[model samples]
Target chain A: MILQVAKSFILESIRNTGVFLGNLLPAFIFIICSWICTISIKSSPETLDFMIKGQFFPISIMLLVFAFAFSSATIYLADLKANNTIHLLKRTNISPAKYFLGIGLGVFLMMNFVLLLLLAGYSFIISLSISALISIILICNFVLLAIYPLCFIVAGIVKNGKVAQSLLVPIMLVFMFSITMTSLFLTINEQQPQDYYIYLIWNPMLYLSDTLQFQLNLNDHTWLPLYQYSIILTILCMVLSIFAKQIYIRQD
Target chain B: MLILDKVQKSYQNHSVLNGISSTFQYGHCYLLLGDNGAGKSTLLKCIAGDEKVDHGSIRGNEHEDVSNLVALQYQFFESYSFLKVKEVIQLFTKLIANPSNIKDLYELLDIAQYEKTLIKNTSGGQRKALSLYLAFLMSKPIVLLDEPFADLDLKKKKQLFGFLQNQVHLQNKCLIIISHEIKGLESLFDFVYIMQDGQFIEHGTTEELVEKYKNPTFSGLEAVYFEVTGQLLGGRIK
Candidate 1:
């Protein structure tokens, strides 16, 4: 039954091709802008690598946070509004755990598919090796998996697709604000002698960025181990999955 | 058989179902008829386990889930907004493992050519037919259809009702229908239940209720409903 639901959801996502393209358009525009702005610049290979490598993680974070939010918000939250498909699923014998896991995994996989396109574009522009890019993507998926269950929580709180759409912009705004503040703090601590970035200990996005940099073998602006933040995210994801299942039942 | 004892449900402070006690037997067609705001739909939702009862219990055969016995076709199911008609049908057939003559059911419902069409693009009547056809294929012991006749043309309506009546008689399933469309459908019901302001005011064989309330100048469910609820019947249920 879980597979059936997941298949149906995937099929539905395919049928709504317009939405898929709309969500993807942002990545295309960002890539086009980057290429256009860099076309006239003359730089040595060292300078180019330094520029791209330094910008890679932060740019990826911005694009990913936006892409994941827009795509998953439209895919799951809109479909979930009014407990639309759920009424049909609840009649089946599938357990709640299997049902949610199937849906979560389905959305995770599809979002990665979209993210891969963006990754390929960036990888090509930065001239990064395929192996290095794949590693970054695999680790980025851990962060993506961690955020989607929380989106389900938001879906449960909203009443319909319209509300979900409206709430999505503001939710993305919150992420943007959080990312900006963390970046500012990181910059401050690096330029100053005293390190006050410890205040960002609770910022999930900061941890995600640091984890990405650590995986890339670059120094994370904060000096946490890669495993530490991933462990924290994994625990948070499991807890959120449990809560999402409970809220899904209530919505049903 | 299915049974509900003191089924009480409320939304916030407003009680939608106040102490509804009833028993539904197998191989019978039950009609739940009521005016607007009469709680007929709420009672059906509770019985089908789609809505939780704040203070009541619903019991089916021993150790059986309510969903095992009853399947619900809600008035406005929103899932159709995304799936294709064929995908929807495939899910039902695959999950329930029920053998179905897909070609015949599709032809009978006049949806054979549109199987590949997206459900979101289907007309209202087509969606209704598809849902009813899928529900028929599942073939649960008890099927609950809330306002099944709302969006069909006359020909499709006749085909659907005839199919429903035949399914009940052939399978000996306990089929429950709740609708305000009470005119001329009294003959299709073995038992009819009436709700007035969240309470069951009257319930019995349709023949008995109509006979008891029938007058020299008036008869049928429309008049019976008028006598019971003190509101003239609207023409929409026809």
Candidate 2:
């Protein structure tokens, strides 16, 4: 049943051209920005390589994850709820857990596939070691796992797809602004800042962005080690998953 | 057979279903007739296990589980707008363990012509037809339909009435419907339930109710509804 629902979700994602393109928009924007940056830094190949690997690639992946979690996953679930598909399936004796698992599996598969493609594209522009590639994949998946549960919670609150779409821009902007601020704060400060801990603790995207920067040896001023970030993210994922299950199951 | 004993449901202290006790037997077509917000659809949801009753029990016979035995078609059918009609059918056919033959359902619902059409592009009537087809496709013994004839045209409504009747009498399936469009289709239902303010004011076979509320001013379910609720159907005057 999970596989069947996942297949149907994938088929629907493919058939819906608008959403499919929206999912790929981050990748397209990354490629175009990389092209523009490549021309400006043509004289210094090493600087260009660092820029792409250390900054562009990781930020793009973050954006991709955000897009998947909010735009694709949230709207898909909201649409199902608004259209009465969830109720219809429930009436047919399909449990909420099975349906949600199928949807989550579908989103996970599609997001990973797109991530792989982005990695493949970047490999040609810069020399990427197998270990670096693996680390990137692992970290991105961690970020996805940490962030995915929030989609269910948000979808439960915003039961209409149209409403979710309308709120997408502002929500994405807020997330981006916080992560960007954290990145700027981390880059400018050499020592661990005491006051920023409260602000920095809540934003998973900052942990994701800076951890990727640290892993690539691009930024050495990371507040925490890679393992600590992973632990924090795992905890966040668990907490969010519990809340998500409660909200989603309670939905009619 | 499905039984609801003293079923009660409420939201934020506003009672939606107030002690709705009834028995829906197999091989019979039952119509839950009421005005808007009269708990018709809520009752169906309770029976289908989509909504929990605040008080009381809803159960099928000893061998049957109410949730497992029932199939429900909601009033609005706007899901899967991106998929083609046939693809939606295929997806559900695969999800359901024992789906009825798609070919017969396609022909019965006249969905063959729209098989290639995207569901978003289909007319309201077509979507309603597709919804009806899916509800019946599950082959569940108890089928609950909420406003099955809402978006359908007169001809399509007639066709659906015939199909539902055949399912009840020939296949011995229990069919429960919530609808207010039963002027000339009185004979389609074997039993009629008149709901008012979240409670059943009267329920009986159409002939029995009409005879019980016999009046020259109105006839059929309309007469019974008027006599019981002291209001005309759709507020129409004799």
- Highest DockQ against the true fold, candidate: 2
Kindly report which residue pairs in candidate 1 clash with one another.
Answer: none
Model 2 C-alpha lDDT versus the unseen true structure: 0.81
Q: What is the TM-score of chain B in candidate 1?
A: 0.89
**Pick by lDDT: which candidate is best?**
2
lDDT of each: 0.69, 0.81
Error in Å for residue B179 of model 2: 2.9
Q: Which DockQ-derived CAPRI band holds candidate 2?
A: medium
Residue B75 in model 2: shift from native, Å? 1.2
lDDT tens readout by residue for model 2, B110-217: 788889998989998788888888998898999999888786678777877888888999889999988778878989999999898899988989888888996688
- lDDT per residue as tens, model 1, B73-152: 76664574678788888776765655345455577677777887887788776787777676666657888888887766
